[model samples]
Structure formats: C-alpha cells, structure tokens
Target: MEDEVLLTLMIEDLLAAEGFDTISAAHETEAMAHAAAAADRIAVAVVNLHLGRDVAGQRVIRALRQHVPNLPVVVITGFDSEAPQADLRGLGGPTVRLHKPGGYDELVPAVLNVMKQVRTGAWPEEGRRKTDYNV
Candidate 1:
C-alpha cells in the first residue's frame, strides 16, 4: 500500500499487525516503484485519496490499474462525503472508498472483503462504474 508517510505508516502498521506483509510509499512515483518491484506479492493497496500533493493519489491509482487491473484499491480519505464516496464507486470493478477517523477494525473488514472479491471474481454489493473523483 503506497501513500504519504503518515497514512503509509499508519496503514502499514495496521496491516502488518494483522499479519499482512506490507510496503509503503509517500507519493505516486515511489508507489509505482514499489508496485512494480512487488507486483506479485501485493494483494491490495490502501491508499489515501489526498497525498498532500496535486492529485498524486489519482495518478498512482491509474498507474496501478493499468499495470494490475485486478489489484484492489481502497481509497481512504479524512474528509467524508457522499459525493466523493460515490465518485470512487464510479471507478468500476473492485475498489472501495472509506472514510478515516473511523475505526481500523472497520478498515480491516473492508480490506478483506475487497481482496476477497478480487480473488473470487465477485462483484461488490452495488455495481460500480469507472469515473474520476477528486479527493
């Protein structure tokens, strides 16, 4: 999971504690590198929608999708809103949009569920579309 330092570390720790082998990135460039190097090992990406830069997260997601279309991405944002969540939902296939300041327990289930969908080729509860949403 590649993201800014703060989110990267937080997610890494959480996932690591949960027994997942984790890698992290602070921005799109590094995230791509990480993804490239660990292509087969990474099961999913827990990305922060805002990387404290100009659409860095969006670019990262696009690149990841191009390289590994089946790679599940769960976009996490501190800001919670229906529009942004709906926008991520527009991104077709198996991606999840979640709000932070919630519980990591919630995140765990979301991560597990999305990855399960990817592994099993199952669609999420609601069918989603591929659309660009500003985080």
Candidate 2:
C-alpha cells in the first residue's frame, strides 16, 4: 500500500485498468487490517517503503507474512539508497524492490512476473529463506 493519496489512486487506477482488483491502505494499521481480513484472496502486494512518521513498509510486509507466508511483495521506495535492503533479505518470500517516481514503469511488470512465479511454483524457494528481485 502507498501512503500518498494521489500515488495510491494512480496505482489503483493502473492496476484496475490492467484488470486486477486492488485494496489500498494508507498506513501500516490499515494495511495489516486489510491483509488479515483478505489473506486468502490477496494475490500479491505492492507496498511503499515509507508510510510517514516511523511506519515502514517492511513492517506491513512482515505483518502480512505472519498470515500469508508466501505472499508476493513489490516494494516501491523513493529512498532507494537509504532503504534497509540488508534487512529485507530475510523476508522469506518472493520480493521485488523498485525505486519510486521512475519505478512506476516497472511496477505492473514486476507484479505480473511475481505472480507468474507464484503460479508456477517457483516462488518461496524450496529450502531457501527468500527470493529477491530488482534489488
């Protein structure tokens, strides 16, 4: 989920146009609530790294994983260099990292790719902790 209303709207519209239904959350709490409630229906998650104040996207990802262990995640961030890439390595599922602003170009493709992997049983690698993409 994205914190910025406009960006979230843009993403929602984009995904909707691509024929995918979307659920949006402006912060971690809303994200967690949505994820928990729809854990069985969610196919993948597109998250922003910063959610204002001290709320990080990684927190949302981790929280969702507690309910859906194999959830695929597309992490979009404006602070590419400042993001905690090292910490994300332990996320234990399929994850795609992208820089914001320009990263929009790759968002849809990334989501589709992750979904493909998930459907093909290529995600959540066997005997492996995690799978990282575009990091």
Candidate 3:
C-alpha cells in the first residue's frame, strides 16, 4: 500500500483496469485493517517502501504477513540503493522488488508473475481454504 494519495489512486486504478480488485491503504493501521478484513480474498499486496511521515513500509508488510502468511508482496521503492534490501529479504515468503520512478511499469508484471507462482503452487499454501473475517 502507498501513502501518497495520488499515487495510491493511480495504482489502484491501473490494477482495476487489469481486472483485479485492489484495497488501498495510506498507512500502517489502514493497511493492517484492510488486510485482516480481506485476508482470504487478497491474493497479493503492492507496497511502497517509503510511506511519508516516517511510516516505514516494512511495518505494513509485516502486519499484512501476520494475517496472510503466504501472501506475495511487490515492494516499490524510490530509494533502491538506500533501502534495506536485506531486511526486506529477511521478511521472507514470495517477494519481488522494483525500483521506483520507473518502477510503476514493472508493478503489474511483477504482480502477475507472483500470481503465476501462486497458481502454479510455487508458493505453497497460498490458495488453500481460508475463513473470511472482518476486523
């Protein structure tokens, strides 16, 4: 999830056009709430690594993962060189990292690839039955 309102809307619209329903969150709380609420329906999360106002994207990723352990994450960061790539890698599960500014072009493809992995059972337990719950 992205914190920038305009960017978040743009990404949501793009994904919607691609026939995927998206849940956008501006910060950690909202992201966690949405993820917990729609844990079963959500297939993946595209998160911005730097959410303005000192909210680190890793927090969002960790919170989301708590609900959907096998969820695939596509991390978009403008601070590619400075970002904590090791920390992200440490988060584990299926992940794809894309550098920002031009990374928008890769977002869709990265999501598609992750989904492909889920569908092919490369990401085990991803499609297993899950109960739907509201937060």
Task: Estimate the TM-score of every prediction.
Answer: 0.77, 0.84, 0.81
Q: How much RMSD separates candidate 2 from the native structure?
A: 4.1
lDDT of 2 by residue, 1-98 (tens): 99899999999988998999999998788888998899888889998878856447887888888888878889888775544542475565687777
Return the candidate ranking by TM-score, descending.
2, 3, 1
- In model 3, what are the clashing residue pairs, if there are any? 1-47
Estimate every model's Cα lDDT from 0 to 1.
0.68, 0.79, 0.75
How displaced is residue 17 in candidate 2, in Å?
1.0
In TM-score terms, which candidate is top? 2
lDDT of 1 by residue, 1-135 (tens): 434466567777878878988877776677889767777777788877666464566566766776677678887776555654324533445777777667445777888988988889885554433343212
lDDT of 2: 0.79
Position 118, candidate 2: lDDT = 71
What 10-residue stretch in candidate 2 is worst by lDDT? 126-135
Instruction: Give, for candidate 1, the lowest lDDT window spanning 10 residues.
Output: 126-135
User: Who wins the lDDT comparison?
Assistant: 2
Query: Which model is ahead, 2 or 3, in terms of lDDT?
Result: 2
